[model samples]
Target: MIKIILLLFFSLNLIGCKKSEPVKSAEKDDKYGDYYVESSIGDATYLNPILASDSASGDINNLIFNGLVKYDKNIKIIGDLAESWSVSEDGKIIIFNLKKNVKWHDGKSFTAEDVEFTYKKLVDPKVKTPYSSDFEIVKKFEIINPYKIRIVYKEPFSPGLISWGMGIIPKHIFEKGDFNTHPANRKPIGTGYYKFVEWKTDEKIVLEANSDYFEGRPYLSKYIYRIIPDQSVQFLELRNETIDSMNLTPDQYNAYKSYFKNYSKFKYPTFGFTYLGYNLLNQLFNEKEIRQAIAYSINKKEIVDGILLGYGLPATGPYPPTSWAYNPEVKDYEYNIEKAKNIFKKYGWSDYNKDGWLDKDGKKFEFTIITNQGNKSRSVACELIQEHLKKVGIKVNIRILEWSTFIHQYVDKKNFDAVILGWNLSRDPDQYALWHSSQKKEGQYNFVNYENKEVDKLLEDGRRIFDEKKRQKIYQRIHKILADEQPYTFLYVPDALPVIHKKFTGPEVAPAGVGWNFREWYVPYEQRKYEMSK
Candidate 1:
């Protein structure tokens, strides 16, 4: 998952500092008036929601598209484009009652066919969507009427009801095109509150209010996502008041807390975790014992304290501490250098010449860890780990790549021996794409090639289970299994520090974090910066 971005084209061209006098809502009293700007580090790879797996694309898609169901402010599974829904007692069937009179941004009527088309595309083997696992269990898709449909699953799938929350695509536009070259992917037209305006590649993306939005028009006249690559530059833009909000780095948050007193600063646990993933396909990491030894050698608490500066928690396993499925009883590989060395010795890893490096089969134990540039926490964590592991005769090289290049050349192709990366977490705990061995196809989410018959079985069982208590037990077992296996040394769950201009109001903290009620946030007329409120 990725956030939105920023650009230099409009620097010092938009708004004023928050210190400016508060004024009345004379410019955009009736909505369609004010514009809010935000920043993103990486540019969007695809605007097509289903085809896009990165966070930047997902964030933009959330605005231009509407899922059938979404998490409410309190994190409850609630209806969005779907007015209501019902589940069969057996939990194998779900029928959705889509909202009536809903129209796509192109003025086309939204119907059950759109949802059906979206689901079919997801499950199509020809289509390379990472989300196909959720739909593959479907026994069949039944359209009862123009505004109603029933989805019958082969088994009692736990995520089935919430899985329909995938954004619906327009079949009329998507069905006939070369999927990647489709105009809809770049300039999308959806039934959500925001209409796509323009995307200037790496510079900026703009969206305007949709008057025919099912819920009603948004309070802001326009929403702009700017592409500012450097976090420091983004903070400067935040200070200069060129952007309304941006996710702040821990250092930036610490420094600007008092400086941006007039701004609305929010601190909450992001659902995701940063990790060091190993390429199991590589010969160096093919040994599970080597991976387990490395896990015991490093100090995760040191990274949490020294790198994150107390803005996060040491990640124990795949699930974040906040998740109901997170198992606190998983076996932890605490920092122990001697124990790591003992494990290494038992596995035929040793430094016979005392050259301060471990070697086996005449090959030195050395590998590189690549991570995307612009993430300070990740870079720092790698640097610290390099130092920590070097003491144990392990050679680690660090390489930072540009965002787009990193994903396209290294991650998607599984070219690196190791990588320090982050996963944009799913609200639902079905981590099939990130962990399932079958999903290791080219361009798929599970690029690491992690495979265990037990993990696969647990994931399958957990998804098919409808009982919350039962699912929790299965996930807990999976967590313990993964913890013992140590595919990725589960790192840290950083606290998201997003600071927004105080002029924007109506934001409240909740289980879903902020931004769920963004459509309701409005700036008073006197505080409005642009006459474009027209």
Candidate 2:
């Protein structure tokens, strides 16, 4: 049987060789085929635009789905399915007009009813979407006609238009079932440039161009998203030409920039944060002085320059540098060991020899700093912090857990002393879910247990302040207050490194995420020829 199989394979190879001669003899090249993109994360969840968490997935979802209003690279609202909109003077109502020509990838007309259905379905408490909170302030959504809709607000909402960021779902698919676990979620239909083709589990998700798309058919006939679990393996795939593009860490970016000099790279500041959070529920950490000491004790510059290898900026607060509301005037807790010691001493944790740690009333000051496992860099950062804090007679145990446990259990319960985590800030300023006092219950993400009337008021005021300048001022004050309270060790704002093959071009890294202009981006045909020639 083996001999027969080998003989058949050789015969087929011989036939293929004979067939290739005529093509080479003609000296003709085939036209570009498709754009193939690869990344570390798999399609663990389906490509439902409403549910995607990361930027790459979100970008692709946006290509497959159209929001009411899309943003430009500068985050300026541009029309997508919504041709235009009008905001009421009182800021409580917004009316939008749907584009009549748009059609879903499934060939359904994109209508205002879909927009209304999306908001109504998500915000309904029965659905239990984490993103439902994004629309909490919305009171009602009314479809006035097939091409028009009106949004009524519970109160003033500054970033009301940002609601458009949630890709409108087709009412036909998700009319029933909690969308979080819906079967339609696994196979979403949207009115963008691409159509869902097939998902090869644990391997790749394929998409074909939607020729009937309103903006004209995409240049690429197909898009293949190869799923590679490990970052190292993903990079290796890029090197081996098995995959074309992937997001890289700073270290990986630097390594590949040198090794694959011909390849292209798109680096941009992420609208996300990486911070060392204080578990304020812990008795030892409840003290404001101790918290401030811990914040000051962290060498942020070292973490940014040494650990992150100068790929990120020192975080001022929870938000990134490019946020419109980011306040430069806010105070940052600088690295000051003496000051940290002074604060620790004032907090009565000065005794150095009480069971290999600092002590207050015979109690040893020791707690674990938890972070997600499988991240070597974060683990190293935690270890370095553990050593640094030890110098101040404080003992920090590092407890690394899987990503889900870290986020849902440790962070939600506020069970750890400190945590290293990241947050992808939403387009709107309603951070109540993460920062409000009401979210301190277990399974919620208010890790700090931080509660301040003044700060709460500032956040509340900022959310309603439509004026961008006013909002900035409010956030500046809020940031300064948070700095003083020391609820978290504001660490570094890391940039995303998307390593792409030289053959494919135009993965622009904007502030929000990579591929902000994904709709119009095209990989030049010349590179396609080069790839085929090779």
Candidate 3:
């Protein structure tokens, strides 16, 4: 599903310490020697951008690769590998002028052929990727020359330009091997600021700065990604200066606001929402009334207050309030136990045997809700939901598995009754990849098996339209329909609480969040801690 599992942290915590003053030095004075160490809850599943869907992989991919276009700090589409591009008058054809000087990490010259190869691989039937939908609408991909390429869409696909932001893979290295099981999937070669050094499974992944990078060498010499599944353990590492950054849990954000002396904490509303998704294929969840009942029974406010420590807003639909597509008029299912029980009773559920739990067709109203391990907020939210559902004569079981196992074995297989997960959204509002009926196949994002013909049409129409006002209406309608359908009990939009060591400079919070200017971030030679190494 291209699910973003990257831990995002936001609210600024500056209660005890004063903000560090900006360095009174020129650009030439910037030093590049220290390392920026960060932690993730899970290890990356694949370094290959096309095959990788999880956010753990995304974190590393962002450093190791570049797309034709990328989002700037203001959330606007800007050039990355491509220097510029122009769309046809009809908006179907786009010609990109690729950067001529870019070099792949393996020292190969990057050209239009690489971008063309990446597009072909994305639509290739043998490749197992969740991102195929984005490129499937393309009618043609043509390489005009060594540094120029053209893309013709089947129609005026609204997300056509931005979809190229998918990481461009190197054709030279991948052409000889099976793209799915390519050796580079584990150890990738790319044109980004960082070059892959080593990946020790379930432990750490390391990369060194590319001196010949087209945009100029990254000021930070090394980028170290450590896998510490437990948030508490990550916090301990952050406190000891072993790791430079991590997303702080709400409790950690609230209670330890003034604890860190050498760290800068940041918090902002994330563009994602957590949800309780049901397996629609399950007989128990196939009924819309049952899903609605479950939604009504959940106390979303309680989750926001208790687990999030009032750091988040209850979600009513797929888009957060920050999104242009968010439907403000679509009301959420109120937390009402009596309404939920009445709906259950109307749907043939009853305590026929005089037991505390409700039953239908001699089967008890019981189901398990699973989420990834180490995310204490989700586990605690599950406990609260278990209590809420129990009060409504439903028995809810909670299971926490390691991240990779949970996604591959359970989520991808649809071998789960229900799951608590979040979607890291793109700035674009076209949700065809996540909600379309055709996307339910294995390795696709529609893991819940949600299918609605009306939604299918709406998603298609939404992508074909280009006008802002028209597209806004289309997505708003989709939001309302999904809100009423209750395929997922849309949960909350939690504030991102990222904390970073204060030694490095150049991070700035913008509309696109921090880390957009990561290449420019540097530590002064006097403050450098780690030595440069391959």
- Top candidate (TM-score): 3
TM-score of each: 0.93, 0.84, 0.95
Q: Relative to the true structure, how large is the alpha-carbon lDDT of every model?
A: 0.79, 0.66, 0.84
**lDDT tens readout by residue for model 3, 395-442:** 999999999999889998999999998887887888898899999999
Of the pair 2 and 3, which is ahead by lDDT? 3
| Model 2: CA > 4 A from native | 1-32, 41-60, 198-203, 350-354, 360-363, 373-376, 408-416, 426-430, 438-447, 509-514, 524-534
Candidate 3: misplaced stretches above 4 Å?
1-30, 532-534
Quote the lDDT for 490 in model 2. 75
Best by lDDT: 3
Q: Model 1: per-residue lDDT, tens digit, 1-534?
A: 111111111111110011112232544464446888987777888888788877777777888888888776666777887889999998899989999979999999999999999988988888867788888999999999999999999998888877777888999889896776688899898887789999999899999978777776777878899888777788788888998987777787888756797688888887778888999999877878888899989998898988778998988888888988899987568899999999888888899778999988887889999987767777898999899899899999999887778887888889999998877566677887778899898778888899998889899988877788998998888888888777898888888777889987766666676776777777876788863355
Weakest lDDT window of 10 consecutive positions for candidate 2: 1-10
Worst 10 residues of 3 by lDDT: 10-19
TM-score of 1: 0.93
